[model samples]
Target chain A: MTAMTAPQTAPAPALIAAERVRKTFPLPQDHGGVFTVLDEVSCAVAPGEVVALLGRSGSGKSTLLRIMAGLIPASGGRVLSRGAPLRGPNPDVAMVFQSFALLPWLTVQDNVELGLKARAIPREERRKRALAAIDMVGLDGFESAYPKELSGGMQQRVGFARAFVVQPQVLMMDEPCSALDVLTAENLRGEISDLWQAGNFPAQSILLVTHNIEEAVLLADRVLVLGSNPGRIRGEVQIDLARPRDREQPRFKSLVAHIYTVMTHPEADMTRMLAEDNAEVERFRPLPHARAGGISGLLELVVEQGGTVDIPRLAQRLRLDVDDLLPILDAAVLLGFARVVEGHVSVSDDGRAFAEADILRSKELFRQQVLARAPLVAAIAETLRQKRDGTMRAGFFLDLLDEHYPPAEAERQFATAVDWGRYAELFEYEADQERLRLPEPEAVAP
Target chain B: MLLAALAIAAVLAAAGSGIGIGEVGHVALLGLATFARVVVLLAVSTLIWTPVGVAIGFNPRLARLAQPVALLLASFPANFLFPLAALLFIHAGISLNWGGILLMALGAQWYILFNTIAGAMSVPTDLRDMATSMRLRGWRLWRDLIIPGIFPSWVTGGITAAGGAWNASIVAEVVSWGGATLTATGLGAYIADATGRGDWPQIVLGVAMMSAYVVGLNRLVWRRLYRLAESRYRLS
Candidate 1:
């Protein structure tokens, strides 16, 4: 909140800005509702500043970026570019997509020339500018190569070259390095930092969406942290560090740690935050998209770190994006296996036992914890026990869940429940029949 | 009706009949005419259905309604229309040469429509967003993004449509209504005429010659285009 308000005092006009943006997508007809992806989120990117929108999977950061670029319209509020309302695609911006999005059939030269061609630049000038842009990205020798022929790293160079060729006022990138190998991603990140320091970057400002906390700390002058479950701005941080920032510096490490804290704050505490922000509290706890194995693996790592570990360091050590690690952490917390406090994760007593126990003992302990802590699994087991035949169709649960969740989310919740229940030996599922039933012995015993 | 005729012809072929090596030149000429007809029909189908299919596919709701309708139309036995088309041609005084092209197109055009729809749908959402952000519109958008995006599927549809058109020509090139029969100068007409006279050896020769043309055209042209699509235009 402080960072959001402080930026309003700046004298320079924002190159791209969003005013209380709200975006909703209609669910399938049978679901009978709309899913709110972003709610009353406001942020701005000023000239000569690199801003990073950071959040996990449900954060809607990418959706917000698209809305600002005017690729899609916000359901409510409006987007402003250069102090004017943007009606269609913003004319003063260029984008690099995470998927590289290069036309597979076009040569590298032609792909870089695509924006120029659209602007009706003459052929001779388009060719010259394209070559210069291609050369700037270190892709001079492969002008005739198709995107499919290039490696992922080289393909992204083309993505960069294409965007840079247009020389838009603001450049937007959606997880540009996410699709590359780790080494390639690192190399590209270093190059970007270098380019920013040299001050010859084609775009005056950059707005990138990323799930990497370290990436935000390294590349962005201002980092806006987004919260999930109807994503809104959770907090903002200003990096006052100088150029060619050192990752090993204590200040840099602390900023990374601070963002991890903001992101990993519990959802229960978020209820009060939601109240203050005047947004609806999420009544149903959506299951984190994590598997039992991943949850246990995360618990083992925590226990190995002497029952507690700093998350950013752990994430750095494991080479995981915040997107990959948060779900597993959420699952562990949901089952009472681990806890996160002030960016530090500590393995609970049960988590230690589960991590150290033999396979059979671990399964028994997992069953006990799931029945005691997981409401959806407990409800499923209780309903199966009450049924005379101990059998029910999965769609019955899906319909019940649809009252609270969209159809896709309802299906995912049912799937997670099935995985947890089956692992606990509380039920069995036949996918071909779409049926759920208690185990034969358990049904007969009751 | 055509199956019964072929079954009778099979029986006639079981009896002894002699064929001449000298017949090759004449059969080859007829094959060239039919080959030309298949190429021309395919080009026309490409021109018409590519745009229509792309339009349908780009709108997902529209595609859902259009796809099944297209499949249903393609499944209708095109030969069922021949007699009606023949009657219209006789009354209207139109040449069977041109009328035959329309009849063949009936069975073949749907292939391009459906394939183009699938291709348009498969163009990655990310690419579309990039295009929109870059402000690529109108002719620039089609030339740079949409056309290349759908090229591979278009080639695939074309191969199947050409195969269907060549098969349809056997019935399409010769149309009969009641006692009236119209014949066009192509390998399909030659085979139909040979079968009507129960000239078993000529029937076999004409069938072999048509098969040679279809297989050769696929090998020489369609296969090359398919390879180019696989190499250059395939989306990762």
Candidate 2:
């Protein structure tokens, strides 16, 4: 990618550097083995640069951001802050969160002044600095309001103020707008980009972790797509557009389209990716986490246009980024309903029929497809039917799934199975009791 | 079990073997002494536990070790501890006044410990990450993040510990160890003495006074603190 050859404009100082950062979560009963989350992930943010990590959910983008913030230690490799190896949380780095993470007990002024209070700043100076920071984040009048009393966007403004009050060199944001309404999110995004462009923002550089393709192109100078399953950088695209880039422009639309392709390119090589481990993994590995509603939603959309449509056009029509669209696509592919060929998604006959059918008939179709294709779901249903009690512990299936995939991913897939299986009326999972029971034989058609 | 005893005592009073209305003042004065003891015991236990409970709460390994030991101590029965306490303090002549408070505290402190542990463990990880990114560690971490986070739990612990201290004072006040006996002048001692001598009037009076004191304390004091914790310091 041209991102690798971006010229060194006066060799800007590196604010944050993540070199081969790897994180592994320990398994409960895997003895010495561990579940690798991020493997050999490397990136850096230089002065005047904004890099975005674009990927699907459960892709370790958030974990990578936390590593950059020095909030958590990597299992292997190192993170450097301001050109020095960082051992723990560094004062020069800060983060904004998806949840805002403001202290609900504290008022906005106190929340904004949190870092200053921790550093033992004198009371008078702390108040002045906190207010200035609050005003900078456009939260001037809401200083005395409690976090619970503020809107979601206002609360996040407090989050931004708290991070900026410390004047961090590298500011890391993990899905900062993911929790807000579109209008509020767009307003805040415009405000942030405006501040950064006018040289009014305090942070030297920002690393934004988001799954929105247009958001990545609009906000960052470089975009990196993190591939799931031991998240690694699969592709990088450099955005060369100028400030305040128009979305209606042909170039901006093309850049967004190009990223969609790069993110999905790995799916074609998925068999090769699995073959490196074992041939059985391609078929036996647990499915990606997706809901029946999401799968059906994608099915209905794809089948609407005579059961065939280009993906880029579908994405444009649906306004879904690759991250939001691909899970449903993967679910369809896993269920034998649709397949992606070249740049187009073509719905199978069954998918089209299911889309046209009413509720009961569609569920019947789903039940048939799931029973035929998903081994874990079929096994669960069979075990429940054979047992006199008509129930089995969820841990049994979780352990079975773990034999094929990493523990956490296996757990996610098992949860997805429970959702789809329940939707298809094949099995019912009681989360509180952790039991899976067979569906009622005399179940109503509805 | 104790509340049931008090209720049965209430029914007996309605059945005619009740405390005479004239001796209410004397029982009220005695009730004051027992109430004073409960306060002293609660204050001392809170002082010790607020630190230790909070420390154990923040550390998982320490919390695991603390759980079984604290449970054992809490359920050990304060009456059993008084014999050892009386023996230790009799020769030094400190067994009469402060011995009751010390014995009551040993039973009550665990309420504060376990509840505080639950609160500290639930202090959301995102908030902790905020602390780290803000470079707040060590003393700042404890004072700013952990302390305020545990306030609601502390209020809950304090209320339970206060009630448990009152229940404990009956056995803890007039403790007899081996061949020796120590007595403190409080409603707990008065009731124990009355029950021993079969004085129905004094027993009813004492039970009624204690019920009054506990109900009054719950409504006038602890309830307000509990509401404050729920409204202002609640994690949600």
Candidate 3:
């Protein structure tokens, strides 16, 4: 519904758009197939609005940003810049990288003038514009300083100056503040907000990719939440709040909470977004990056709170961001030990039992939960049981998982499965040998 | 001033030892020739390998294959080819002067390639992506991004290659194939010739002169460039 509402709300055509875009990278090994990063995902940034592409890691938000910038090509579909199919690098966009990707050898002024130099602007004019951009970012005296001499915040100011110097139609920033310290990040965020509010920002529109939900609410006119595992747009929320938004405002807090809920319910959102249901893929999605101990810790906390808690409030109480809390919540939900309805998380009866039980009883419950709900761990146990020696190389399972996940993600999933399996006593891992074996019958008991 | 003092001490010591002043002068002249040969060969090696290394380093696929091959080639003892090189010079009537430069390059060029490859590889993906998003291309990209990105690595390579060339000169300046020797008019040849005749004073003078040149070059040229690389060109 919000996706449909985008067209009616926008006053102008999109400055940049991805039309049914799909991108795939070659599998790292010789599997002879591709790994899909973005699959038929489409979003747009029109003039006069700051659009945030928000997602956790592996959601391909950055990849999508790169595609829209024409830094990399989409395997399928088109990236339209000013209503034309983009070719090579998009000439009308500039980017601020999370790394503050300034040339270390160049002075701040030279770094700011780089885009102008690339465009073949005359050197004197280039210097004047670069100096002005530098002044605008409050980096006037830093013009002669190299990036290494600057602090992270100062370096990012240089990054902003470089991007603004180009005066492109769309300014693309990839997690622009995520790499800074919390205090510095907040400071930069406020300054960026101030610049946007001042109404003299050089770019006509802004596109930001970030995993920080509060950041999206604070900065974006409309936030598009991206889903991972072959990234697709899961949901879109239009932030109707005016600029210079307050984080403590009821509307702002609610929007942040709503986006957190949408991000956590991957399968529910996917089914709603697509016409056909692909339950198998959703069921076998890679395990969340959470340990048994962490999941138990979260369950105990929820139980202490009377078994039901609003996710955002719980995150705030724990002083953890949604990104940190979501994975643990996802793991607990995946094991059928918890359920999330709306933005509130309620521990299931099994979760309460696991949280209160003694260590041995907890392991028994964990073993049952993992075997019944975790397909990868169950498959490993089953495969090891069928083997003559009751053992298999870890690579065999990794190779199997490579078809569904990227190599790094596959490796992570296998490691998580190993951790859970070992904790449940369903399987034993030989660290040095990289082999997995079923637990002996006696060891499996208790 | 320090180098000049060392050179004077060496010349006076050689002359006082009853090795004629003319002989010490000749040895000093030969040191200059060998130094010139090393400088020229290093320039040539850098010119050829910097671009090739940049090309290979920027492409991950090519770098994976070429890196090991360059290492393998660098490890192969260049002396094993000296006899063949000598025969070619003899047959083609090429002077040992030119042949010596080629022989030294054979041993020294790999340092540049290796360092350049590493430098190019170390150029951050973020910077390259930034350059791409800015639409920096061709010459501007090279000037702004690629060159400075790899400068520190290239300087490291240049330093190593120059050292390798100096060491290679002792063998490369004088080559022997099938009982015939081709000797270039350089300090390496002078040392070899002195050793053949049991002329210890001349040999000492030649070694001292060669050492003086290597130390002077390292201190004056390579050190400054290395400081520049560390101070300005380094990626944080």
TM-scores of chain A in all candidate models: 0.91, 0.85, 0.93
How high is each candidate's TM-score? 0.89, 0.87, 0.90
Off by over 4 Å in 1: A1-10, A29-32, A267-284, A348-365, A382-415, A429-436, A440-446, B1-23
Model 3, stretches more than 4 Å misplaced? A1-11, A266-285, A379-405, A426-445, B1-25, B176-180, B194-212
What value does DockQ give for candidate 3? 0.72
Task: List the candidate numbers ranked by lDDT, top first.
Answer: 3, 1, 2
Error of 3 at A335 (Å): 1.7
Provide the clashing-pair count of each candidate structure: 0, 0, 0
Which one wins on lDDT?
3
Model 2: per-residue Cα lDDT over A355-431, one tens digit each: 77898999999989998877667777888889998999999878866765666677888888899889899888888
**lDDT digits (tens) for residues A56-92 of candidate 3:** 8888999999999998889999999888989988888
Least well predicted 10-residue stretch by lDDT in candidate 3 chain B:
B19-28
Model 2 has a DockQ score of 0.65
User: By lDDT, is 1 or 3 better?
Assistant: 3
Which pairs, if any, clash in model 1?
none
Error of 2 at A371 (Å): 4.9
Error of 3 at B210 (Å): 3.9
lDDT of 2 by residue, B91-192 (tens): 778956677888878878888878888888878878888988887777777777877889888888888888888877788888877899999888888888
Docking class of 3: medium
TM-score evaluated only on chain B, model 3: 0.92
1 versus 3: better DockQ goes to: 1
